[model samples]
Target: MLRVLAVDDEKPLLEELLYLLRSDDRVLSAEGACDATGALRRITRALESGPDGADAIDVVFLDIHMAGLTGLDVARLLAGFAHPPLVVFVTAHEGFAVQAFDLKAVDYVLKPVRPERLAEAVRRASDHLGRSAAQRPPGAAGPPGPPAVPLAGPARHRPAPDTGAAPAAGSAAAAAADRAQDLIAVELGGVTRFVAIADIAYVEAQGDYARLHTDAASHLVRIPLSTLEERWAPRGFVRIHRRHLVALRRIDELRIDAGTTSVRIGAAELQVSRRHARQLRDLLMRQATG
Candidate 1:
């Protein structure tokens, strides 16, 4: 059973999240907070007093925009902890979607939340916790360390295997790779459209849909930015703002103006949130130098 803590300033949205979470049998416990300060207090309390004095929080569902301290601020505070909960940013604003992922958040959920979307986010959190637990060193109480790098060694040479088996293995591997790279399909005007992963310049979250910007044109799809971010992030997509996820390779220019930084992709200019400016600049610099 996964332990979850949800924080949002909006009472209605908070209640909705609580209701959706409670319906899931996999959830062991759920706590809700209406503001950042209160949420932080609750989280600290949970850490201090574990479930049955054994288990602590496994995941946090956070809202990016809140009164006093924003969800991003809360995440930064938690980052200082030795064992921070896995964060999933839940917000109605798409502008922060990219910025959320840039924080290394496990997932993002957009409101008004759908049951299917909430279920997917919960599943991802559970999987992340399971993998983290499996990777921990013997007797370790918290998250695991960085992944180990395999040591260099001479190539393990072996005699050519049977032709039949070799071709079958290669075919299976290629098929799996293709499946992993399959494009996301979106329906518009009663016609289904597919956006190739490589062709997407960026995705911007509007009120209810995300706009897919490509070299040729733009298309609107009725899917939340949070869901798209979780699905495409692993495929070379990076969030630069709450509502924007840009393809790192498609970035034509990075500029600073009046103390604010922005990225130019194709013809569209997108701002880099203040919280994400430093990290995005650093990443761009590293790529340029590399």
Candidate 2:
């Protein structure tokens, strides 16, 4: 049985979500909150009281654009909870889909939420919880507690494109591969070879395709730079230009010559666009501080 909490500022939408969740046989109980604060309070009480607690919520159907604290804000807070509930963002807006995935949301359902879509989200959450329980350390009462605060770790998510099917939530290896493609398969002289993602210095876009640059050699693949950017950003790959994405760890130094900024990665110096310069600097600062 899955416990769910549906949070939204709109009373009618909140009610509709609660009703839909209750209709599902897998859902043990469903509750609603008018704001992030109320939702957080309920989650805190549940965690303090353990699984048998009255207000326990296994999954949260969060609304992205709430009145006070937005759904993202709420999720940021939950990331640190001792027992964080799986999140499933419900939104009419699609723009937050990438961020939702970055937060490791169980699912993202576009609003006016359909019963079928909501049910699918519940199934994924159940699968995830089951996997977590199975993988717990021997003799442990439960899975390890989450961070005391949301750590600024690298992103762990696949590309934002929908595949018409949810990924298998039971496989931890699958989740890891989604975040970082450890071995990139590329064709060299008509022979396919794998390159370690850690060895790649940077990626440069070549028309419809992108080329991965390593210390010794470069590999060109059919993947688009934008797609790689979306997938690898969490893995410390930052888009420094419209056509270039550089691995943060590979950057030797940032150089400013005649007011133009560029990053030196191995033997290559990739220029940074004005729009991405500040963001790159901030990311570097965060990485350094953390």
Against the unseen true structure, what C-alpha lDDT does each candidate score?
A: 0.75, 0.78
TM-score computed on alpha carbons, candidate 1: 0.48
lDDT of 2 by residue, 1-290 (tens): 89888999899999999898888899888988887656765776666556556756688889987643468867867776556888999999999999999988989999888888888888999999999888977666553343221112223447768868856767657778754567888998999998988778889999989999888889999999999999888778989999999887666556556657787666677899989887876665444323
Candidate 1 residue lDDT tens string, 1-290: 88888898789889889889989988998988887656765666555654324436778999987644468866766666667788999988888877788777998888888999999999999898889878978776754222211111112348757666445788789977886577767777899977776778899999889999878878888898888888877765778899899877676656666778787776788998998788775555444322
Shift in Å, residue 72, candidate 1: 0.7
Per-model C-alpha RMSD: 19.9, 18.6
Best by TM-score: 2
CA lDDT of 206 in candidate 1?
Answer: 100
Q: Considering summed lDDT, which 10 consecutive residues are worst modelled in model 2?
A: 146-155
What is the TM-score of candidate 2?
Answer: 0.49
